[model samples]
Target chain A: MKIVFIFLISILSVAAQLTLMPHLSFLAATPNLILASVLAWAIWRPEDKKEWFILIPILLFDLVAGQPFGLITLSLCLVFFCLEELGLIIFKQNDLPAVFSLTFLGIVLFELFQVLLSRLFAVWHLMEPIRLTAFYFYGSLPFNLLLNGALSLLFLWALNKSKIFQNNGPLAKLK
Target chain B: MKDIDKSKWIKFFIVLAVILLLIFFNFRGLLSAPKSWALFAASPFLKLFQVMDKGVSGSWAFFLAIKDLNKENAGLKSENQFLFEEVTRLKEVARENELLRQQIGIGQAEQQRLVMAEVIGYNPTLGQYILIDKGAKDGITVDLAVVAANNFLVGRVAEVNANFSKVLLISDSDSLVNAITQDTRISGVVKGNHGLGVLMEMIPIDAQVAVGETVLTSGLNETIAKNLIVGRVEEVIKKESDIFQSATIKAAVEFDKLEQVFILFP
Candidate 1:
């Protein structure tokens, strides 16, 4: 059942990323809703899932987004692992400010990884790393972080209402 | 027993290892088969979305025209009459030009193979690419140059699936074209300017060039042909003591207005 929910979210996000973003894109950057949702899940949910759930979406994004196969998957997995550690050591779960901060950091890391990795692995990415990095940080940070927050809130709400996160559910014992 | 069970971190690591292997295979061209299936699955939704988007935009345009119908109709009537007279004069001039060309023994260039396509998707994060509806099934392979209205170079087909392909616009950071100034013949390499515009770099500092001079492909390379208008020089950036100079460019095609493009298979 949870797998079904994850699959739905992944497909919808990929579809939206491909079909809807061009109409709404400004300055060539848009908030990545799937990245935010998965980061939120990694930070807020217990560490048992290991973001194995998001691997499908990352792989799908690779194929559809025209990025090098496995680049985003690797980056998302690394982000998931880092978020797990950050949650364990500092932020912990259920903290609003922490969640927000995590979302911001997650986006930073996500874009940074993408840009740097594209420069390294992908064909023909010669845009100055500093300029691309600065655009995301200065030009897009506020709008994207807000959107990421809203998406995280929706994910949190959905996870909260799910029976799997409820008492006597599979995750409850892990919690 | 539970303590001896495999940990999630271990599981995650295992997946990461597999992904890394796939990345290695990607460099070997081994990962394309699975990716083709993914593209095949996504193509239907992209087609549906393109249809719906066109419908919505078309209706919006209709209402927008309705708002200005009276004002535009009055102007269009006079413009139509002027265009009809101008076209008649231009046709006579064209006939004379063709005669002169024949006398000089210049003939039309060979017909180029073209495949028309519709813009179906754009992903800015993937370093500036748009998905077009025509693909391998439509004879669009990689490295074919795409042109918009007036033969303006829009991009080149980067990746192709069965029913869809991705065009990497010249405005993308990774894109490079060998270009020269049309008026002065100052040559340089044009690169995408952070997805906002393009930059012509690697020109010698002493070269004479001016803003608004046309830049066209030098045809020094096999990927893109010669004499295709790239952009008009927007800004000339010259620095003393620097070996090379650069210019900002404004591409001719209005990308936001792009809907149809032709792929030059030749």
Candidate 2:
């Protein structure tokens, strides 16, 4: 049931990302909905081994994406793996600072992976070569960080405040 | 603990293998059917969210513009009267031109066939593209030129599925179009500036150009038609040492506000 819930949320977020998020962009930066949701969920339930179910949605995003196939999935998986391992080793609790820090790092890592893969794919003639410039990194990084950070913070606050992840809620067993 | 660690590694390898397979299949053109199916399944939700977004944005815009409604209404009323007269004059000229063409042994000017499509999605993260609700089934093939109202150049059809297609916006970094200035007749390559804006590049260093001159497609490219408005020159950048000059262009089309577009058929 939890797996199904994750799949549905992922689908909805992907749909919103492609359709609705563009209208909400600020400073040429749009919040990455799937990335924020996955990071927040990982922090909320670290022991949830069914997280791999997200790959299904990631595959769908890749299919609809303009970039080379599988790049988004691979990049996101690597980020999730690192976050899970690092959280276990460093942060014993899901505190506010830890959540913000992880959110910031996850966004940066995911974008860096995208840039690197885009360059590699260009070399392989998968698409046109992306020009790497300082503006490419600095132009939208501040706004991107702020948007995704705010989203993660909101998710964390709601998880801690609501009874959805506690007591007799549907996902209490997973929690 | 050992079992958990084993499963994690197994999952990682499985993901890696899947990625490899996807890349291979995508490059070999084997993923088109699956991709088409995916787009087909996701199209309804995309269209729904797009309509919702338009409604929300429209209401917000109306709320914000309430203060200036009187001024805009007065301006639009005068502009509409001028356009009404201009249309009447153009109709008279068109009738005379048709008779002249017939006398010159030309039967008639061929009319351009355009297929109108609604934009359902915008991808700003991975690339600058908009998904339209028309595709191979509607004769929207790859590389077809897309235009907004007033014959303003938008972009080209990048990829096509059965029920939808991806239109790469002219502001995308990968987009390039052959364009020429209206007055000066100086030709250049108009390229996207990483989605920041559009730039007309590769102009001859000695060519005479100025700001506010309209840029149009040169028809040098087969896919795009000539005389289609690309944009107006916003700035001119000339250097003594450089072989080619470049200028920034201000496109007439508001890419963010595009709800519908027409695909030009050859």
The number of the candidate with the highest lDDT is 2
lDDT of 1 by residue, B1-266 (tens): 34423465677779878887877787676766676667666667766766777788779889888989999999999989998998999999989988998999999656777888987667776577887878788877888888886778888888777677788889987788899999899999998875778999999999988998999989875767778888999999999989999999999876655778999866
lDDT (tens digit, per residue) of candidate 2 on A1-175: 7766665666677788898887777766788777776666666653334567667677778787646677787788778877776677676576777777788888888888877877888788877655666766787788888898788768766766775655565676762
Clashing pairs in 1: none
Task: Give DockQ per model, in order.
Answer: 0.53, 0.66
What docking tier does model 1 reach?
A: medium
Q: What is the TM-score of each candidate against the true structure?
A: 0.79, 0.88
DockQ of 1: 0.53
**lDDT tens digits by residue: candidate 1, A48-100:** 44356777777877766645566677777778777777876688655778877
Q: Say which candidate scores most in DockQ.
A: 2
Residue A169 in model 1: lDDT:
63
Candidate 1 global Cα RMSD: 4.9
TM-score (C-alpha, index-matched) for candidate 1: 0.79
Model 1 segments more than 4 A misplaced = A1-5, A46-50, A119-137, A140-150, A157-175, B1-6, B55-101, B104-107, B137-139, B181-186, B202-214, B231-247
